[model samples]
Target: MLKIKKKFGIDELVNLTSILAILFLAAAVVLPHVRAFRYFALIPWLRGIGLGGLFVFLILQAWIHRKKVSELFGHRRARSGANSALQIVLFLGLLVVLNSIAAGHRGRLDLTSGRDFSLAEQTKKIVKNLKTDVLVTSYFKETNPSSMRARELWKEYSYLSPRLKYRQVDPDKDRARAIQAGVKRYGVSVIEAEGRKVEIEGTSEGEFTGGIIKATRGEQKVVLFLEGHGEASPNSQDQENGGGLSTAKEAIEKQNYRVEPLSLIAHPQVPASASLLVVAGPKKALLKEEVSAIASFVERGGKVLLLLSPQVKTGLEQWLKSYGITPDDNLVLDYKQHYFVDASAPLINRYPFHSITQNLPDSFFPAARSLSADRKMPEGVSAAPLLETSDSSWGETNLLSRNLEYNEGQDKKGPLTLAYAVDVEKKEKRQKTRLVLFGNARFASDGAFTAVGNGDLFLASLNWLAEDEDLIAIPPKPPGPQPLVFSNGQMMQVFYAVMSLPAFLLFFGGLVWWKRRRS
Candidate 1:
């Protein structure tokens, strides 16, 4: 003990104290992220005591070198050099501190022409008003482009509110943890809140932000799609036949809704928890019992969405007529403004002032039919057109005709109804039944849903029907348009200007130097 005490002199003590002070300060900066460091008993004590000991050692060292310190201070060169060093140190220190504060309280400016880098207002509102903390963990390979893109996008979420925290994990380096988290593939993310988790497989803003919303919102409302009469399957991937509604299903799921195939033939009654029932593009006629079950469900204040294709016999004429809704059998033809390939695929840019169609873009309907409401509607039932075609469009009587033309007396007039929203209320009861009818289901199918505002329009309709009006109006921010292509001659001019300017300057400089040396 005497030898050890002799070896640990004042000079050695000062060095040890200085080193300890640096370590403790580093721990203070790093502990928040490490989390487990706080459990160490020595860290808290070291933070307070280490810094104090450093100050004491500094004072003692100064006292021991009093004469030398006074001589150094008196020398003009030494004082000037010390002042210069101090000024540099102070300037660097200020820079570091300002940088840290700026990073912590930074505001993001999305200067992209389309505001593509910014989150939607709806998403910002949701994240800002979150009641619980939502953690978004991205599982991706370090070298993946999607990982970088995801990091850039999720930065907005982290900056929007304190409740949202974004984290990225290298799945390859942390294989065990990634597997435990159920991340089987790269470029996927997991959002967790309140013990509930939602996995997003896509990197689009719609998918990731939707997952955050789903995870934060605890309960999932069931959206049942009617099956059994050869309607488009939600699970189908056949894009050409319009047999898939995967895109529509995903959009609804993002809004904290669950999509399930519901068959009235298999089940006697609609599930009590069914938020909305969708009957989309049924080719075969529904059984009488199935129709009865749907009627019962609607009578009990259930919401319904009916998407009928042109000339498809579903045998719901009487059932629809009871609600003062008429589904026309004629085919919708847009000769003036239609998809390039077919005139039957009408391009509809007109929308009425309704919640479902508000802020929606032009939607293309392939093989669309027309809808008409009774002039005298039922007592408690009110109807309004949600989407419609222009005055140039007409409901053609013959869909089989290769050279189609509007028949004078047999076909419906121009400006036909393509979609309608209806509200049915009972006077004595508080229950109300809501319904939406779309002339064409193919537009909302997987193949065409992402085109224009088809997905947005469908989501809005579902939100209104489910009484979730708050989630209705948010639209996806598409990326900016591609830059203009330059011709080879134009490119050559740019190349020559960039490459020759510096060379020309260097040549002129060398010539001037040569002339001066010769002179």
Candidate 2:
């Protein structure tokens, strides 16, 4: 080692000092203009300074020993440079691979285990049919989890189509811009496309996507409220006194649908724009011409919503037979103890397993009647039950008489069908015509509109009729109470015991066994 030190020279020190000075000058001149490079310049400056100082110390040590500087570091300089270059290349390669994977999979990877991908099909359909550029600006509160979820969902939208642009706007930070854009709620998405805009409130990506589809789709949907048969009318005195037509009309209008009153007898032809015809609780029977016109409308791919009551006449029942839907004259009576409200009264409590009622709560039905499928079902028509009475229910055949008490064998035992949805295929055009025949229309009346999922059921049926069932809003789960208060000390103790007892036992037992073994 002493013989090697004798070969180190003074010229190496001068070269190292020159390199350090040049690196410092480059860092000082370039760092101020380039933000990214400023951070990187520090690394080279520190290396130059550190290596330069070491070289100077080595030269001093060599001078004290009367040795040449080249003998000390000449052989190691080339190896050190090669090793550092290789390490830097390895780091850069790793960084590029990791960044590429992250960019490709960022939005696709969901950290939320409970995320739903069921609406991906519908989302894809909208994306593939995009005619023009669409911008989705999401307004969210910075601290809200729903805001984060909305961003994640928007990322999926962007991933699906390059035409769609997703932007996040914080209402708190960008107050003036948010106000000008008319964002009322946190986590609301405003979709703008083709000179049109739609504001979608709530935190549902499915609903927001549906709103975009509806806004872009040029055809206007018209929901006709059937009148002139003592049916509830949107502008009628009956609604002012407590009818459902006005409420239902308002709800439908909010969804960008036009509402109109149509009397088949008054104007025999169903309007071309009519997507759905609602016959809500008609007290009178339809005339022959009216019945024929409705049948023609159905044959021409028009949707019909027939909401019947126990008061429906015989002529209407015979007319409904053309579509294979038979509304029973008998009123349903539930004997189940678990049924909501008075079980003895004509109230429906249980709903059948169908799209409309699948996830609905146990809905209450006031004065509900029974419906059945006739053997006269049209060819290629599919029927599904929407609502039914429990097995403990009986349909009182003599609807005129209000006698509740009856022998077990005297009454028809359920599950009795109360509402049936039929999708009839048109022979001429091969288009599916939807018909919903409900035994009790009063469930949708103003009197019982809010009875559990009554309004939701009505909305779902209308959407189904229009072949826009995916637009129906799924009711959000009720939020649990926050900062749950323990009412009593005993309750608090019980809660702690239930939550921590097993963990405490396991931990203490393990600790005791470890301590004993060590002892």
Candidate 3:
């Protein structure tokens, strides 16, 4: 054994002891306060213990060698630059690891992009009251951009609730599973609950999420076309060489509404699930029993969309009177705002300010009837005008004769009421029954449907009546048509005068100068 002297200074021992004590206190108290430091304390404690044992071992080695403690520990000069760089690298590494753990390796935490916040309240109601487990499997392949968009949407649904699980199945890799899951196409989200599955085909999160909401709480809207009169059927031909409502039936059906011809003569009892009853351009009168049934239906929270034509010869007018709606026997003719080739075809353009026609463009109404509300509405019933003729308009009493003579004093002046919506409050329930009366049904005819939002107005009215406004289908954005572009003459003029003329002059001038210089 060699006898050695301890050279460790009192100041060094004090400094080391103080640092160890502070670190221990920080681990005991501060580590619990900070979530990040709690795990760090574990590793630091093991390293400190091992390092402390090593320090004692080094001290023993120093004692044996009888040398300075500084010599055993190496140089004491601080390299600030190197220390800062090492600290920065360690901090960045720790931060990356911690973030990965927190995010569950699910990519960047993007809280900004999501479904409409306004829909959150509605979605909460749907999710909270869901009776069955809804398994939403998004069968999306990475090849398509829509699939990526669908995944992002599914992430929103998952964030809403843990009950909603999203499983990503690659159609190509998992062909067998995809076939079993009934995934016919890529970018398809399948929502299944209570043994019922609805495959909604769309890439838009709003559309896909809306479909899910509809799937959960969708009500079937049925539109009954009052037949037995000369009203147009779904298969009716356009006899007048003008547009017919036959094409509208297909459009309505596409909105998940079942359009069935309801001949009150054959079936007197109105279907209980009838969301709306449509009386379209009837040539004959409604039977007494049919009128009573309609009135009773109106009294019992039912919805009606009445479209009266100038050719209506029915007592349906009287039945409508009981509900405080009176259709005058005259065709609405607007002299100020009309769309027509000649005096025979009168086109009324102005519409009233109502939700149905609020955003609609200027429309052409051909041979529309005039309507008016009684001075007093029935008890608990509310009425609002939808469309009215301009101050220059007049009611043509002799509409069938096709005589284009306007009697100013005889006809009702401008602001002739053309359409109205009546809400009849049911005494039994707090809810009210809706009735929309339009002067003309032919506006929804196939030929005129696309003429300046006429079809949109008709669809909107029907939606309002059925109380299915949210389910109203937005018309698909038309594919890019031939963009109104510059004509050939304009293109040639631009090429020659603006572009080619200047370039040609510059080229010839440069060539002449080059030839002169060379000569």
Per-model CA lDDT versus the true structure: 0.80, 0.67, 0.66
Q: What's the C-alpha lDDT at position 1 in model 1? A: 44
Q: In model 2, which runs have C-alpha deviations exceeding 4 angstroms?
A: 1-133, 138-164, 168-190, 199-213, 234-242, 337-339, 344-354, 399-403, 407-410, 426-432, 472-519
Lowest lDDT sum, 10 consecutive residues, model 2, at 478-487
Q: Among all windows of ten consecutive residues in candidate 3, which has the lowest summed lDDT?
A: 476-485
Q: For candidate 1, what is the lDDT?
A: 0.80
For the record, the alpha-carbon RMSD of candidate 2 to the native fold, in angstroms, is 14.0
Q: What value of lDDT does candidate 2 attain over all alpha carbons?
A: 0.67
Q: How far is candidate 1 from the true structure (C-alpha RMSD, Å)?
A: 11.8
- Which residue pairs collide in model 2, if any? 6-68, 7-68, 7-71, 8-68, 8-69, 8-70, 9-68, 9-69, 9-70
- Clash totals in order: 0, 9, 2
lDDT of 1 by residue, 1-519 (tens): 455436677787778878877877677567645523323334445455555665677688888798998898898999999899879967975775566455545677989854666777667767777888777899989898888989988877766766677889998899988989988888889998899988888677777777877887788889999998889887787689998998687677778899999988877698889988999899999988888888888989899989998878787879999889888889898777675446787777889898778767667888898999999998888998988887888999876788788888888987889888999987876658899988898988887777766777888888899987767776555344523322233456678999999999999999999999999
- Judged by TM-score relative to the true structure, which candidate is superior, 1 or 3? 1
Candidates in descending TM-score order = 1, 3, 2
Q: How many backbone clashes does candidate 3 have?
A: 2
Cα lDDT of model 3 by residue, 135-238, tens digit: 77777777878777777767766555545656678889989988998778887778776666778777554445545654555565788888877876666758
